[model samples]
Target: VAAGPAPPGTAPGGRRPWRQLALLSGLISMDSSESSVISVLFPALRAALGLPLSALGTLVAVGKLAGMVTGPLWVMLAQRVSRKTVLVISSGLWGVWSIAAGLSQNYVQLLILSTIAAAGFAGGGALVNGILADLFDDAHRGRAAGYLYAGVAVLLAVVGPLLGLLSEVHNGWRYGFFLSGAVTVAFGLLVAAFFRDPGVGAAENPGVGAAENPGVGAAEPHRGGPARPGATVLNRAVLRELMSSRTFRLILVQRFANTQLAMVSFGVVYLVDVFHFDNATASLVSAPAAICFLIGTALGGQIVDRVQRRLPDAGRLLTWQLATLGWGVAALLATQVTWPSIGIYVVLFCVLGVLQGFNPGCNRPILMAVTRPETRSAAFAVMLSAESAGWAASTLAIGYAGSAFGLRTAVLWLVVVLNLANALFMTLIHRPLRREALALRAATADTHPRTSGAENR
Candidate 1:
């Protein structure tokens, strides 16, 4: 179909953007399946490999550290190829490494293979975020992100218990890898056949590719020439522009300061180790917490969208800051203070999950707002890479600290304290975020004057 201006309240992907969103979410879901399996089944892994607690940290760290480099590399690769091609190869076809990792009989082999798989998985985040920005306009980006992540959370909720059940069988973690790898490969095939590129800036300037709307769509001028495969390369000027944005820089710092990943990565292990629960019993928390997180994302997305409609400038940022702060409080209560029952812990974790959902629903839309469509993939690549580095550092620190001190104390300091600090740091972004967002709106109006009437609302 010819690309042109999308109708009001419609996405550039035509009438069925949710279908595209679902496919993208399914692809992105595989990105973390391997890591989740490793995290959830670490007890079995530890027993089988005679691994130390710190080894969990090392394994997770290696994958994340690999992602820190490979994430950006994949984004650059997408520019050379196409986002769909790179996404399929990295997120889908790379499942072969996952299967190989599952076959490993030793820690070294497992680590090496999983790292290779992770390098491929890292490609999905930047490419998907960039595409989503083009698929939906700013007004609905939060809801789009919410639905995408909520889908992921739903899968995690279902899979978490199954992995727990699998832990009961000898070498069941291997089966988890095998299953994840197979499913990912299948999804890759589906994406290759069905997924459509909305073209860069298609949502913002929907009139793209129309007779009168020259220099838009896939070959939009600001994004550089036509949509020839392998024609686009890394644009250094765009990178510099991204770096110059005070809001973008502050967002990077906020992402780097995030340590909440450690909470999810280690929560199951903490219950198994500290609370003396079996794997099956400990995993019960995962399903409910994930469900709550799904609710959080769904609700948070709608709430942020409405708030932005009213406040525009401060809404999303304020919501994100408050959510971060709330998550820290929940983490402290869930971790630092001992509860008498696992049920209590479950309820608290549900609260944590809900608060956790708010961050992505808010921050992702903010990132899209502050960036030009041309620079979005690179922006997300850098931002997500920073987050990967932070996750690696936090996981490693918690692992060693859990050994040196205790998991309880380590959780208290790293997850709770750092999250609180990050929330406070987010305050600095308010002014810059407002300024940059307004500037982007003005620029979009100038570039697509015909759509300015609709966009100004």
Candidate 2:
């Protein structure tokens, strides 16, 4: 078929958000699968190296700590440099480091190599998230984000077991890393060749080009476009603007508390150590639960979008946030019990997986709603840094606690308490999110009067 005319306002060669969503999804999948696949190799690693449980925890903690510093650094650099260039460089470098991690002869070598890889990997989250916001307008961002994150969950589900099978072979885990790294390096080249910038503020309001191109025949330039040059990386003005937003502050706190559920880091370990399942068996069972989670993500995204259309003023998104927490609570209860059959354990985990997946479809869209397009990347970077810190601390704590007590007790206590705290923190965002969302929409309409017609209403 002959190509259709480029969509209005899209750059000559730029791909539409939906079209690019799949490519970005592939990037996200490759970025995360390495970590997921590695988690499954923990048992083989321990057996081969004669390492302890604490070593695994230390690796996870140190890697996350590396991400905490590098996440924001990548965002700042992207603002000064460009998104596509930064992404390509970071992806290529990390791919090399990940392959090196597999060749480590000792625990110390592996830890150091993995942390260096993680610092490079940190660019993916904030940079990709910001690009996503520019691709889809406000109305479709919820579903768009859903499709992207569902890819991550699905990729992890597949690679987790494949790596487990590999771990059964002598020195097979090293080969798995080699394959993953090779795939990532190839993908990075593709991103550099094909991925478009989408330009900041490209999709703030549908049917409006003013946000992307200001000062066209107008008395004054529109304020809705991206930040101008000469603004320093993480300038004080941007920091103050972000800090002043109540919604931003509340979301940051919620993100920190929620990281306690970084259970995937130790989930396979949990099954192997406590439930007495082999690595392959645990991964096989977890795969179906991941599918259940993907289903929940699809349903959650559609339901929340419909609710937002119906009750934009009320805390509809917040209601879904609470619903997610309710699912977590149920999953926690299920895990706490000893079932007569392993099938029941699988069923409970599926429930937990589904519940866990519900939040991602809504969370990033919430952040986009409150912040300007220019600042969205920084916003994500800030949130990620805080989240990484939380994860690092929790991983260290759980590792030590599991050694002193047991994995079951440590996971149970931390998951239950932190989640309850997260639920309470979410309540504070209900009003602030509602208020900020209105302000953003109104500002977009005012800046782009062409879209202020009934099409926007």
Candidate 3:
């Protein structure tokens, strides 16, 4: 496989790359905050509506289901239109739905509005992951993902306290939702007006190759040539090719199993219910964990990148991924034991946060390595859809289980078992990774002969 020279914006560079990273991270943070905010505001929402605790599960499940359906559609739209255009439109529209959700008069209306907002939120991961791959080549992807996700974690941490305060007010949760929606809408417009779309394979086709195809990232029609060939084409054959990869399928399954943790949707609730912390205290306690998560994310990404560089054909990335999952399983299992004090629990939470941090840096880099650029968005769409299904399944199951068996028991049981399953599923990806990595590099070279030629030179 042609592992050509490192592409542009792939490593230490100027502020432009950081600026792009910050913008994309901010977008994702906004989307992620929606999911977190709901959890923080759940108790208040339930009290106001006179709803049972189980309603939270339904709320989460419905949103996940909606995301499952719409994720692929966004991928298809991005294929036909500009990635930037699709993202701007989806983000803007969803922001409207998000705001309207706050105004819902009843449970059903709230559910419906939240689901609509989720449908728009679902598209973000597919678009952003695909775009990031183009912005930074393989060498730098780990650190880039780490920084992006760390920013998200930090941002969410910062807002969690505010949301907690909102929960104390009679109708304050509504304002939190309204504020989130308006901010997202504003960011969406900013992205539309200012965000530049890096070419589809711009990182891989650096130097003169990239310059020759300045229009690669846009929605404009190809002129006097066959369609510009890259890895991210949308069609049956491409889909089939993507599906055929055993590593990719395993990656998807691992993702599915991981989502079964359901922590993101219910973590704060677990802390409150099990530890007897009030809303504000629960949110505040979780804040430090987010900082730990950020550090772990940054450190883990750097370690994996260094490991891969030193052991190119040794499959160190797989080792790091599996290790991260193993750590997660252990940390989660530790949470099952009733802790003697809040301090001990916070320590466990921080450990879990670090484990959680390891994943973001590893997962997409694996996907990008095993697949080509044209297939990347489709690959992400499928991945996101599977993740949504997992989220729906886990949220509903845990939500109901929590209502019956107790939140702590239900969450702990699921986290331990499902993460173990995910780790096992990831093993199947191990043997195939080298082969897939070679295939992706070969395909990239084949798709862009100029890149191959430059590598040869």
How many residue pairs clash per model?
A: 1, 0, 5
TM-score between candidate 2 and the true structure: 0.89
All candidates in order of TM-score, best leading: 1, 3, 2
lDDT of 2 by residue, 1-457 (tens): 2233347645322345565676777776787766765677888888888988887778888888899899888878776666766787776546888899889898888888888888888888887887788777666666777777787778767776678798789998788778778777887888776665656665653322233432211112224443333212566788789889998988787777774356767877777888787877776656777777777677777776667667766434665577657766865765466666667767877777777776766788888888887788888888888788787788778888989999788888766667776777677788888888788877867875543332132
Q: Which stretches of candidate 1 lie over 4 Å from their true place?
A: 1-10, 13-15, 209-232
- Residue pairs with colliding backbones in model 3 are 231-373, 231-374, 231-375, 232-373, 232-374
Model 3, which residues run further than 4 Å from truth? Answer: 1-15, 207-218, 221-227, 230-233, 314-316, 326-330, 446-457
395-449 per-residue lDDT for model 3 (tens digits): 8888888899987777766766677766766666777887878777777687766
Q: For candidate 3, give the lDDT.
A: 0.73
- Return the TM-score for candidate 1, rounded to 2 decimals: 0.93
| True-structure lDDT of candidate 1 | 0.83
Off by over 4 Å in 2: 1-14, 205-232, 314-316, 452-457
Estimate TM-scores for all models. 0.93, 0.89, 0.90
In model 2, what is the error at residue 194, expressed in angstroms?
1.9
Q: Find the number of clashing residue pairs for candidate 1.
A: 1
